[model samples]
Target: MKKPAVLLAVLSFIILSGFTPQTGIKPCYLSLKKAGDLKAGTADRLLADADKTRMLVTEAGEVPITVTEGYRIIYNNKKKAPFVNLIVELSKPENYEQDKKNVLANLSYLNAQTTGMETTGKLLELDYNGYKAYGLSRAGISEGETLGTFVIFPGDNMIIYIYFNNIEPAKGHFKNAAEYQGYRNDFIGQYTAHLAKCK
Candidate 1:
């Protein structure tokens, strides 16, 4: 398959798998109830707004998963809520390595494709639920004035990406660097809890 096609396939797999990864346990679909119950207040607040479906259409094709949904969150007293969408897929890393060389290569390609990028953090390899994964931070790539993160969890046959962005508020984005990192850490902690509860 072409590079893009293969990428899409891998992405599709990640999206289809939900948070269960490819472990022995069955994967669970995400929902407003599950998200709202999470100790992560921000996450609960975000998902509390809606319980809807999403269309995962890619050049490779589409994955039919009705549980996918979107939500809006009001941050820093902003009146306009940013629309958020979640896509889940299930697939394995065809060339995953201990040092994450494959992921680094892919990140390089993504960085090149990105324009107006202000900054990007180093890619860190970490484990989630006994599964090897990679996480990175970035900013200034979006022209829509969005600030957020991108995380990838590479599993045996499940690669999950969490794309989160918030529209720039009138007062500006996060209060400061510390505030941003705090939110990011909270998000990761809550997300891990949600995944555990789902299974």
Candidate 2:
């Protein structure tokens, strides 16, 4: 497979892993009741609103159980309240080394990708998922790491990481960064579970 295709596959699996069995589909996300329940139109509408953009979800693609692929929705679903996720696929790192490297690069890229980027504090290094992890927090968000992080896998081919946090201006986007963190927490937890299954 081509590199882009592989990356797309990786992205899809990681997103889909968050859903539970009762979710109707194999990997459907639970809706936020407060958000007036999750409607198909909601995801579409959120994608349309740039000003209300505290989160985003785009389609990745999946072939289902046999081997999912194509285009599917990946976004930060806050309507269901806390714990949003990517669109689909839901795969995690089986190879620890590569996962770490790929993940770190993604986080670093986000600093460059997002608008008005300001990085504060030191880049923290630790260990998680059997790989050395490094977390970089933007300066203004209190004491904890609040921007993005990367998990370096064993080699250099694959790296697993997630980028999130409040970073919102208290009033707009997400209610606060902590709310964003809830989505991050969900993404990581489901991804970790997927990794266990892959192993």
Candidate with top lDDT is: 1
Clashes of 2: 48
TM-score of each: 0.45, 0.33
Mind giving the per-residue lDDT tens digits that candidate 1 earns over 1-199? 8999999999998888876633321234233222222221132223523433333432334432222222222222233333223333333234233213333455444544455443443444445454443444444323433444344443333334554454454533355445544454545455556566665
Single out the weakest 10-residue window by summed lDDT for candidate 2. 62-71
Model 2 TM: 0.33
Candidate 1 yields a Cα-based lDDT of 0.41
> In model 2, which regions exceed 4 Å deviation?
1-73, 80-122, 139-146, 154-156, 165-186
Give the Cα error of residue 51 in candidate 1, in Å: 26
Per-residue lDDT of candidate 2, residues 1-199 (tens digit): 9999999999899878756433112322322222212112232212222232112221222111211111122233344222222232222324334333344444555555544334533345554355454555443344333454534233322323344434334322445446544444445544544444445
User: Residue 120 in model 2: shift from native, Å?
Assistant: 6.7
